[model samples]
Target: MIVSDLWRYPVKSLRGEPLREAEVRPWGISGDRRWMVVDPSGEKLWAGEHHDMVTVSAARTGQGLRLRAGGRPDLHVDEPVDGPPVEVRLRGVGHAVSAGDPADAWLSEALGRRVRLVWLADPARRPMSEAHGGRPGDVLSFADAAPLLLATLPSLRQLDDWIAQNGGGAPLEMSRFRPNLVIDGDLPPFAEDTWNEVQAGEVRFRFAEHCDRCAVTTLDPATGRSGKEPIRTLARHRRWDGQVWFGIRVVPLNEGTITVGDPVRAEGTRSSR
Candidate 1:
């Protein structure tokens, strides 16, 4: 198998950016989910609950952070905010960081509510889950299950065909799922189900679980518009293990930069044990 695509979300619970190459870190890709939006009470916000204008895309510019929406001009933050420290959680992991007032103001105006932007640099941080056996260097993420998600081209095509038969307009692009790595092999749907270890370049990842479908998939990553086709199509044909499975979650066993076209080798199968 070969890698066909890669992505990163600079801010948790927002639109993601496609990357040609990226530096891998213990928690995840550098800058991936390093920032997040939260309420005045330090509660983190997510696309799944609040489908407001706050689902804007963000990126790191030479100066600082830049944000843009469908019709809004880009907002930039060159200086960090000064505020009382607060703890934010990704899944269940907690991180103590400061929130910038400018970010809060921008987000408040965009969503027509009060909110703030928090960074993940405080040493008091802890990952959200203990089930995966959080490692010393591992960073817990807001991802549905694992720190990384992997999908195969053939499986996506199969879903597209199935959607077409169900009268869904077109096959959605892989971006809708926001996977960190998109592999090019012809694997069956849920094929990662049997994989325990996979190697891409020098990075090693352990397949953990299947990512279940969520309402966030209904939102159009392009325009931030919500629809019913993708979720509806998935519900009818993708349900497995009592849940609608869509992607495979993975945790990096070893860290290294994985680029597009990198060869992928599965080390062991579930049945091998």
Candidate 2:
């Protein structure tokens, strides 16, 4: 198999930027989900709770961060090198730095709700949830769970076929699932479900768990609108233990750079690394 795509979300719950190459860190891809929007109480906010969040696109600018959405001028904010620290809850309460009131006003105005832009500052602040098969020292960013999620084109095609068979409507875009890596090759559909480990480019990663679907996956990234095809279809075919599953989460065993077209091989077992 070969790596087909790479993406990094500079901010949680916002549309991410696609990349041809990225540095894979133990926590996650560099610049991936280092920031998030949270309520004044420091609770996390997501597109599932506020669909308008999906309409906003966040990218890393040369100096700091840039946010854009319809009907608003792109707002740029420099990294808050000296900003006040704040505690925000991800998997657990962790620390972050506020991007100041200008960013807050811009994001709040765009989403029609009061929220603040907070940088993770330290991606390792949150540990992966042990309920999802995490072990000690497994760190994460603002990503909902494990460091990287991998989705395969073959599996997506399988899901599309199921959707068609059930008359569930249009095939959904992979972006709805927001995987960090997309791989394509001759593997059977959902083959990744059983993979114990895999290597992509120079990085080695162990399987963490299957990614569970949520309302966010039903929202169209372009319009912040919800649908009921892929999730509905997955519920019918991929459900188990009261949750629908899609991509697989992976924890990097070694950090390095992975690029599009990097050959990927299922290692079948954890590497000595």
Choose the strongest candidate by TM-score.
2
- Predicted candidate 1 versus true structure: per-residue lDDT over 60-88, tens digit per residue: 67536787766666788753544556766
The 0-to-1 C-alpha lDDT of every candidate, in the order given, reads 0.71, 0.88
Q: Which ranges in model 1 have alpha carbons more than 4 Å from their true place?
A: 53-55, 78-83, 89-95, 122-124, 132-137, 142-144, 271-273
Candidate 1 backbone clash number: 4
CA lDDT, candidate 1, residue 36: 80
- Which candidate number maximizes lDDT? 2
Evaluated at residue 238, the lDDT of candidate 2 is 90
Q: Give the Å error, residue 258, model 2.
A: 0.7
Model 2: CA > 4 A from native: 269-273
**Residues 1-273 of candidate 2: C-alpha lDDT, one tens digit per residue:** 999999988998999999999999988999898888999989989888898788899999875999998989999989897999887876564678999999999999998889999987777767888977678999888888789999999999999999899876777888989999999999988888888988999998899988889999889889988888678989988998899999899999989999999999995543211
Model 2 lowest lDDT segment of ten:
264-273
All predictions: root-mean-square deviation over Cα? 2.9, 2.8
Error of 2 at 187 (Å): 0.7
Q: Which ten residues in a row are the worst by lDDT in model 1?
A: 121-130
